[model samples]
Target: MSVFADLHRGDEPLLLPNAWDHASATALAAQGFRAIGTTSLGVAAAAGLADGASATRDETLRLALALGSQPYLLSVDAEDGYSEDPDEVAEFARELACVGAVGINLEDRLGSVALHAAKIAAVKSAAPDLFVNARTDTCWLGDGDGDGDGEETTARADAYQRAGADGVFVPGLTDPADIAALVERLHAPLNILYTPTGPTVPHLADLGVRRVSLGSLLYRRALGAALEAAAEIRAGRAPHGATPSYDEVDALSRRGDLTHSDGP
Candidate 1:
C-alpha cells in the first residue's frame, strides 16, 4: 500500500493542511506534519489568477517542484488537471510524479462527468504510483447534497473510483450522515474538507472519513488576518496577536540548498 493507503487504514483520519507556498509547507513539515498539500486558491490569488478556472498551471507545477525535495509528502491541487484533454492531464501527472509529488487533487467542478472520469483513468494509466484524489463540486457548485438534480456526489465518487481514482474529495459536505454514506460506499479513501460547522476530526474519523483537508480555509483566514493587521497599522493601532519575527519567518520559508554547507 502507498502512504495514502496506509493513512486511510490508520485509527484517525489524515488531517491535511493545505499550504500556499514553500514557507507554509516547510513550516508545517517542521511542525511534524508528514504530508502537505498545495492550495489552488492561494496559488491563484498570489499570482493574480482565479481558482477553479484552470489557470496557474505553471505556477502550481513550480510550487510542486519547490516542495518536492522537502522531507514530506506533497499533494497538489491541480484544478481540472489544467486541461480538458485526458492525455495532457495524464502527462502532467507523470511530471508531478517525477517531481516527487505523491498525490494530486483533480476537481470536476460541474463540468463533463465523463471527461473527469477519463482524466482519472489517464492519470492512473500514466502514473500508477500517484494517488489521484478526484474532487466533486456537487455540494459547492449547484444543488446541495440533498437535492435530486445536477451532479450527484455519490454517483461521481463511485464513477471516479471505478475510473481508478485513489480517493474522492467532496468539499462543502458537512452532514455526517452523507459523509458516512460516501465513506462506506467508496472503496477508495473518502476525503472531506474540514468545515467550521462540520464534524471535528475525531467525529469524522468515527464516521469513517479517511482524510480531512483544510482546503483554502487556512489560506483565506491568513489573508484575512493580514488585511486586518494592515488596516490596524494604517489606523495607528498596534497589530493584534503574536506575529513571528522576521528571522523566524525567513527560517520557516527556507528551502535547503545543497551547494552550501552550514558547518564552520
Candidate 2:
C-alpha cells in the first residue's frame, strides 16, 4: 500500500477534510492535516453549477491546477468521472495524476454501477500510484436500512469492492453497528461520510473503518456560517465566533511569494 493508503490502515480511520480551493487547502495543510480532499459541491457551487450531476469539468481542472503545487496530499472528488464514457473518465484520471493528486473519489451516484466500475478500473490502470476510493450510494439513494440499521449498507459496499475498488464509501451511513458490519464485509477499506449522528474519528477507527470523509459537510457548514454572520450583522448583533485575521488568510495564499521581486 502507498503511504497514503497505509495511513488508513490504523485503528484510527483517517479523517479527510474536503477543500474547495488553494487557500482552503493550504490553510488545512498548515493546520497539520496530512491529506486533503476536494469537494465537488464546493467546486460546482463556486462555478454556479450543481454537483453530482456531471457539471464543472473545466472548473474542477482549474481548481486542481491551483491545488496541484500545494504542500499537502490532495484527493479530488470527481463525480462519476464527469462522463459515462469509460475512456474519457480514464483520461480524466490521467490528468488528475499529472496534477499530483494522490487520491480520487469516484462515485456511482448516477446509477450504472458497471460503468462506474469501469471508470474505477480505468483510473487505477492509468494511474496506479493514485488511490481510488470508490463510492456506492445505496443508502444515499436506495432503500438500504429502511429501519436505520447498517446491514443493507454492507451489501452495497461489498458490491463496489468486488468491482475492484480500493476502498468503498457510504455517504449517508450513521449507525455504528452498521458501520462496523460494513467494514467487516467490505474487503477493501471502508469509508463513511461524517454526520453529526455518525461515529466520530476514534469511534470509526474502533469500528474498523479505514477512512472518514467530510464530503460537502465542511463547505455547507462554511456557507451556513457565512449566512449566519451576515444575518447577525444585519440585525445589529455581533457575530458569535472567532474570526481569522486578514493576515492569516493572506499568509495561506503565500503573500511572501506575491511580495517577492525574485523568482521563487
Candidate 3:
C-alpha cells in the first residue's frame, strides 16, 4: 500500500484538511497535517469561477503544481476530472501524478455510473499509484437517509471500487446508522465528509470510517473570518481569534526554500 493509503488504516480516521493555495497548504503542513487536500470550491472561487461545472481546470492544475513539491502529501479535488471523457480525465490525472500529487478525488455528480467508473479505471491505468477517491453524489444530491438512497449509494460505491478506486467518498451522508451500514459493505476505504452538524470525528471512526475530509469547511470558515474581521474593524472592535503576525505569514510563503528572495 502507498503512504497515502496507509494513513487511512491508522487507529484514528485520517483527518484531511483541504487548502486553497500554496500559503494555506504550507501553513497547514506547518501545523503538522501530513496529508493536505485541495478544495474545488476554494480553487474555483479564488479564480472567480464556478465549482462542479468543469471550470477551473487550469487553476486547479496550477495550484497542484505549486504545492505538489511541498513536504505534505497532496490529494487534489479534480471536480469530475474536468471532462466527461475518461481518457481526457486519465490524462489529467497523469499530469497531476507527474507533478507529485499522491491522490485525486473524482465525483460522479449523480451522472452516468458507467462513465464515472470508466474515468476511475482510466485514472488507475494512467497513474497506477495515485489513490483514487471515487465520489458519488447520491447522498449529496438526493435524500440521504432514505432506504432507497442507501441502496443507490451502495450500488454506486460498489461499482466505483470495482473500477479500481482506492476509496469511496459520500459527502452528504450524516446519519450514523447509514454511515455504519455503508462502511460494513464497502471493500475500499470509506471516506466521510466532516460536517459541523454531523457525527464527531471519534463517532465516525467508531462507525468504521477510514478517512474524514474537511471539504470546503476550512476554506469557507477562512473566508467568513476575513469578512468578520473586516466588520469588526469597521465597528471599532477587535477580532476574536488568534491572529498570525505579518512576518509569520511571510515565512509561510517561503517554506521549503533554502533562502528567501525579494524578486519572484
Candidate 4:
C-alpha cells in the first residue's frame, strides 16, 4: 500500500490538518504533521472565489503543483471533482496525481447517488493509486439531530465504497452512536470531520474512526487571529498569541529551495 494509504490503517486515527497555502502547509509540516490537506474554503477565500462552486480548479492545480514535490503527503479537497461529468472529474484527479498528490477528497453534496458513484469509479480508474476519500454531504447540507438519516447516509456510503472509494467521509457526522453505527456498516475506513463541539479525537478513535479531518478550522482560526491582531494594534495594544519571528516567516518561503539541489 502507499504511504498515504497506510496512514489510515494505523492504530490511532490520522489527525489530518488542512492548510490554505504553501506557508501554512510547510508550517504544519514543520510541526511534524506527515500529511497535509488543502481546504477548499481557504483556497476560495484567498482567491476571492466561492467555495464548493467549482471555480478554483486551476488554482487548486497550481497549488498542488507547487507542493507536490514537498516532503510530506498531500490530499487535496477537490470539491465534487470540480465538475459533474465523471470523465472530467477523472481527468482532474489524474492531474492531481501527476502533480504528486497522493489522495483526493470528492464530496457528493447530497446530489445524485449514481452520478457520485460513477465519479468515484472513474477517478479510481484514472488514477488507480490516488486514495479516493468519497464524501457524502447528506448530514452536511442538512440540519437537525439526523434521527432518521442514518440509513440514507449508510446507503450513500455503501454505494461509494462499491464504486471503489478507499475511504468514506461524512463531514457533519458527530454523534457517537451514529458514528459507531456507520463505522460498523462501512467496508472502507471511516473518516470523521473534527468539530469543537463533537467527540474528542481519542473518543473518535475508540468509536472506530480511522481518520479525523480538521476541515477549514485552522484556516478560520488563522483568520480570526489576524483580525484580532489588527484590532489590538488599532487599540494601541500588543497582539496576543504565539507570533512567529519575521525571519521565521521568511525562512518558510526559502524552504522551497531545499526541494531542489540547485538554487532557483
Candidate 5:
C-alpha cells in the first residue's frame, strides 16, 4: 500500500485538512499535517466558478501540479472526475498520479450507483497505486434530516468497495449510531466529514472512523476570520489572532531554487 493509504491503517484516525491554495497547504504542512487534501469548493470559489458542477477541472489540475513538488502527500478532490465518462475519469486520475498526487477523491452527488462504481473501478484500473476515496453524497444531498440510515448509503459503499475503492466517504453524516453502523458494515476505511456540531474527532475515532476530513471548513473559516478582522480594523480596534509576519508568509513561497524576488 502507498504511504497515503497506510495513514488510514493507524490506531488514530487521520485528520485531513483541506487546503485551497499553496499558502494554506504549506502552512498546514508546517504544522505537521502529513496528508493534505484540496477542497473543491475552495478551488471553485477562488477561481470564480461554481463547485460540484465540474467547473474547476483545470484549476484542480493546476493546483495539483503546483503542490506536487511539495514535501507532503497531496490528495486532489476531482469532483465527479470532471466527466461522466469512466474512461475520462480514469485518465484524469492517471494525470493526477503522474503529477505526484497519491490520492484522489471522487464524489457521487446522488447519481446512479452503478455509474459511480464504474468510475471507481476505472480509476483503480488506470492508476492502481493511487488511493481512491469514493464519496457518496446520499446524506449530504439527501433529505437534509441528517439521518443516514444504512440503506442507500450502505449499498453505494458496498458497490464502491467491490469496485476497488481504497476508502469510502460519507459527508454530512453526523449521527454516531449511523456512523458506527456504517463503519461496521464497510470493509474499506470509513471517512466522515468533521462538523462542529457533529461528533468530535476522538468520538469519531472511537466509533471506528479511520479518517476525518475538514472538507472546506478551514477555508470558510479563514474567509470568515479575514472579514471579521477587516471589520475590526475599520472600527479602529486592534485585530487579534496569530497572524503570520510578512517574512513568514514569504518563506512559504520558497520552493527550493524557485524563489520570488519581487517585494510586497
Candidate 6:
C-alpha cells in the first residue's frame, strides 16, 4: 500500500485539502499536509471551462505533471476520467501514474453504475498501484436535498469496491446516521466531503470516516478572499486575513533548502 493509502489507517481521519495551482499546493504543503488533491471545479474554472463537462483533460494532466515533483503525495481529480470509454480512462490513469501521482479520483456524476465500474476496473488493470477513490454523486446531484437513502449508494459503492477501488466517496452526505451506516457497510475506506454545516472533522473521525476531503471548498474560498481583498482596497480599507509577502510567494519556486521526498 502507498503512503497515501496508509494515511487512511490512522486513528484520525485524513483531512485532505484540494489545491488548484502550484502556489496553492505549495502553500498547503508548507503547512505540513501529507497529501494534496486537485479539485476539478478549480481546474476547469481556472481554464474558463465547464466543470464535469469532460473538458480540461489536458489542463488536468499538465497540472498533475507540475505538482507531481513536489515533496508531498498528489492526487488528481479526473472528472469522469475525461471520457466514458473505459480504455481512454485507463490510459489517462496510466499517464497520471507515470507522472508520479499516487491517487486518482473518478466521479460517477449520477451516471450508469456499470459504466463507472468498468472505468474503475480498467484504471486498476492499467495502473494497479494508483489509489482510485470512486465517488458517487447520488447524494450530491441526484436528490439536491441530500435525502437519498443508502440503498443506491451502497450498491454502487459495492460494485466499485469489487472493481478494485481503494476508497469510496459520497459527497453532499450530511446525515450522521447515513454516514455511520455507510461506514459500517463498505469494506473499503469511506471518504466524505467536508461540509461547513455538516459534521466537523473530529466528529467525522468519531463516525469512522477514513478520509475527509475539502473538495473545491478551499479553491472557492481563495477566490472569494482575493475578490474581497480587492474590494476592500478599492473602498480605501485595509484587507483582513493573513497575506503572504511578495518574497514569501516568490520563495515557493526556489526549492534550495528543501529536501524533496519520493512520493508514492
Whole-model alpha-carbon lDDT for candidate 5: 0.93
* lDDT by residue (tens digit), candidate 2, 170-202: 887777777776666768888888888766778
Of the two candidates 2 and 3, the one with more favorable TM-score, higher being better, is 3
Error of 5 at 135 (Å): 0.4
Runs in model 3 lying further than 4 Å from the true structure: 144-148, 255-264
The most accurate candidate by TM-score is: 5
Q: List runs of model 4 lying over 4 Å from the truth.
A: 146-148, 255-264
Local distance difference test scores for all models: 0.87, 0.80, 0.93, 0.92, 0.93, 0.92
lDDT of 4 at 105: 99
lDDT of 6 by residue, 1-264 (tens): 888999988998999999998888999999999899999999999999999999999999999988888899999999899998999999999999999999999999888999999999999999999999999988998766764757999999999999999999999888888999999999999999998999999999999999999999998898899999999999999999989887677666455545644332
Tens-digit lDDT string for candidate 1 (174-246): 8877777777777888888898877998999999998999999989998899999999999999999868787
Which scores better on lDDT, 1 or 4?
Answer: 4
Clashes of each: 0, 1, 0, 0, 0, 0
- Report the lDDT tens digits of candidate 3 across residue range 1-264: 999999999999999999998889989998899999999999999999999999989999999988999888999999999999999999999999999999999999999999999999999999999999999999888865523388889999999999999999999899899899999999899999999988999999999999999999999999999999999999999889978887777777774545675633
lDDT head-to-head 2 vs 5, winner: 5
Better of 2 and 5 by TM-score: 5
Scored against the true structure, residue 55 in model 3 reaches a CA lDDT of 96
TM-score of each: 0.93, 0.90, 0.95, 0.95, 0.97, 0.95
